[model samples]
Target: MKAFVLDRYGKGRSLRSADVPTPELRDDEVLVQVHAAGVNLLDSKIRDGEFKLILPHRLPIVLGHDVAGEVVKVGSRVRQFKLGDQVYARPDDLRIGTFAEFVSVKEASLAHKPKALTMEEAASIPLVALTAWQALVEKANLKKGQKVFIQAGSGGVGTFAIQLAKHLGATVATTTSTANVSLVKSLGADVVIDYKTQDFEDVLRDYDVVLNSQDTKTLEKSLRVLKRGGKLISISGPPDPEFGKEIGAPGFVKLVLRLLSSGIRRKAKSRGVTFSFLFMKANGRQLREITPLFDAGVIRPVVDRVFPFESTNDALAYVEKGRAKGKVVIKVR
Candidate 1:
């Protein structure tokens, strides 16, 4: 199997092409022959060792999570899929190696790819789509007629969040550069603010929820845009502890998150709003629900670019540019 291996975390230079053995299938796993992979900002953060405290990986790791591929073999205990099934997942960690020709993933994480999309399009959905789904529907419990603002609306998570919010009958507002205002609007955002020229906080008010994917300052301001008793869900760092516990973070990490968000939580409480941090978990169940939306044309992927399998590193670099209109994908077949 061919893979891009990273022995040590540092700059993008660590990514290198090499031949590696195909991963052995676990009794509860499936061996997927990679067809396409999605490159995400989380991949960049992992490569730079930003997540070392929470997710420590073994050395000489393969760094990709969002994958779309055909199942060549299934584990003895796996029942959901079989050989030749087309599946997709954002494997829980970097070691699964979606960058390779083949990778093994737990059955709980793999979902049947939506029939309406190609492998490249299917690959782009798992991580970002799941993040949006969990934050809006699961955590925020968004309901019809509620108003929600999704920051960075043209980015991967934001694009999906806007679409899903609209599908749930929420009035969605989003922030993006002037260039992406039309794109976000097309994705069902009722209001699109040119982030470069206008401050979202100044123009919007009384939201049911705010999906924060930007820096600490932006996350702080998001609270002001929500109504009393409204929720602010942040996917970016400065994590919240109770939220960490909800996602099953372990002892030490849970304590660290509490300390990280103590001040922010207090501030939010003073304003009569709630704050939660989201780190999306891999779930085949949620993916199953999302597939019908894709199949029905209610939600569609927005692909910014595609790179050949051998150029996987280039795809990662492209995503790092912070200007992609949507997700970047690696065509691994």
Candidate 2:
């Protein structure tokens, strides 16, 4: 099996391609022949050791999260799928390796690909779409006629969130460059702020929810955009105590996390709002629900580019540039 291996963690290291032994399937897992894989900032951050404390991985691992492939083998307990079933998934934390010819995925984390999409399009949906679902549908409970602000509307998570928020009937506001103003609007954003010229804090006000995916400066500034009792959910984060407890970190790590978010928490409280960090997990059931929306023409993929399998490094670099209007994928088959 040909795969890209991350032998060590560094800021600018490229993964080395190798012919490793094929992975053995577990009782609740399935072996998938890779067709296409989505690239994310999460992969680049993991390679640079940005998540070492929260998500520690052993040296010499395969790195990827989003996958759309076909099942060639199934484990004993995996009754939901069999040979020749098409599936897509954001595999579990320690088990991700879609930047390869073949990868093993837990059955619970995999979903049937939408019949309306191609393999590359299906690969682009899982991670970013699931993040939006968990944030808007599960956590915020956003309703129609309410207002929500999603930062970086042209990015991976941003593009999907704007669509999902609108589908839920919320009036959506988002920030993107002047060039992308029309792009976000086409995705159902009611208000589009050109971040290069106008400040979002000045323009957006009294919103029900704010989805934060920027740095600390942007996170703090978002407070003014929301009304009292508004919810601020940050995906790019200084992890809060709640997230620390969710992951069951050590006491010292928990204390450090509390201190890291103390300033933002206090500011949010002073403004009569609530703040929490969101680290989305993989869920097959949520993906199942999302698939129908695509079939109904309520949502569509906004893919920016598709790189060849061998140019996986180039794809990562392109995403790191922060210029893509939507998701980037690698054609692995």
Candidate 3:
């Protein structure tokens, strides 16, 4: 199998192409022939050693996360899917390797691809869509008629989140550059602020939820836009103690998280708002639930570009630019 292997973690380092043996499938896993893979900022962050404490991935690892492919073989305990089944998934953290020609994915974290989408489109959904699902649906429990502000509305997660929030009947507001206002509005954002021209904190207020995916300054401003008792969920984060406990970090790591998030927690408490960090996990069940929306055209993927498999590093570079309108994909077949 051909793979782009990361030999070491560092800033601005590229993955090396290499021939590696196919992953051995487990009792609850399936071997997928990768057709397309989604590139995410998380991949870059991991490659740069930013998530060492929380994730602790082994060295010389394969880094792709979201995959859309066909099942070539299924493990003994994998009853939900069979040979040739079209699937998409954000594979479990320890098992991710979709940058390769074939990768093994746990059955519990794999979902059938929506028939309405192509492999590249399907590949783009799992990571960003699941992030939106986990943040808005699972954590916030966002309901109809409420107002929510989602930051970086033109980015991968933001584009998906705007559509999901609208589907849930929430009044969605988002911040993006002036050029992307119409794009976010097309995705059902009711209030699209041009961040380059205006401050979101000054314009948006009394929101039920805020999805923060920016720097500490942006996160702080997002907190002010939420009404009392509202939820402020950050994906780009200073991981909080609750998240530290969720990941079951060592005592030292927990203390680090506590110190990193202490100021925001205190400020949120004083304002009667709740603050927490969200790191999305792979969930086939949630992906299955989201499939119907895609099939029905209620939610659609926004793919900015599809790079050839050989240009996987270029795709990562494009996403790292922080200007992609939506998800970037690598056609890996």
RMSD per candidate (Å) reads 1.4, 0.8, 0.6
lDDT of each: 0.90, 0.94, 0.95
Q: Give me the runs in candidate 1 sitting further than 4 Å from their true place.
A: 243-252
What are the runs in model 3 whose C-alpha is more than 4 Å off?
Answer: none
Model 2: worst 10 consecutive residues (lDDT sum): 52-61
- lDDT, residue 223, model 2: 92
For each candidate, give its TM-score against the true structure.
0.97, 0.99, 0.99
> Candidate 2's residue-wise lDDT over 1-333, tens digit each?
988899989997999999997888999999999999999999999999998888878879889999999999999999999999999999998888999999999999999999899999999999999999998998889999999999999999999999999999999999999999999999999999999999998898899999999999999999988999999999999899999998889999899999999999999999999998989898888989999998888998989999999999999999999999899999999
Kindly indicate the candidate among 1 and 3 with the higher TM-score. Answer: 3
Residue 234 of model 2 has an lDDT of 94
Instruction: Give the CA lDDT, 0 to 100, for residue 27 in model 3.
Output: 97
Best by lDDT: 3
Candidate 3 Cα deviation (angstroms), residue 260? 0.6
Q: How far in Å is the alpha carbon of 136 misplaced in model 2?
A: 0.7
- lDDT: which is higher, 1 or 3? 3
Error of 3 at 93 (Å): 0.9
Q: Determine which window of 10 residues in candidate 1 has minimal summed lDDT.
A: 240-249
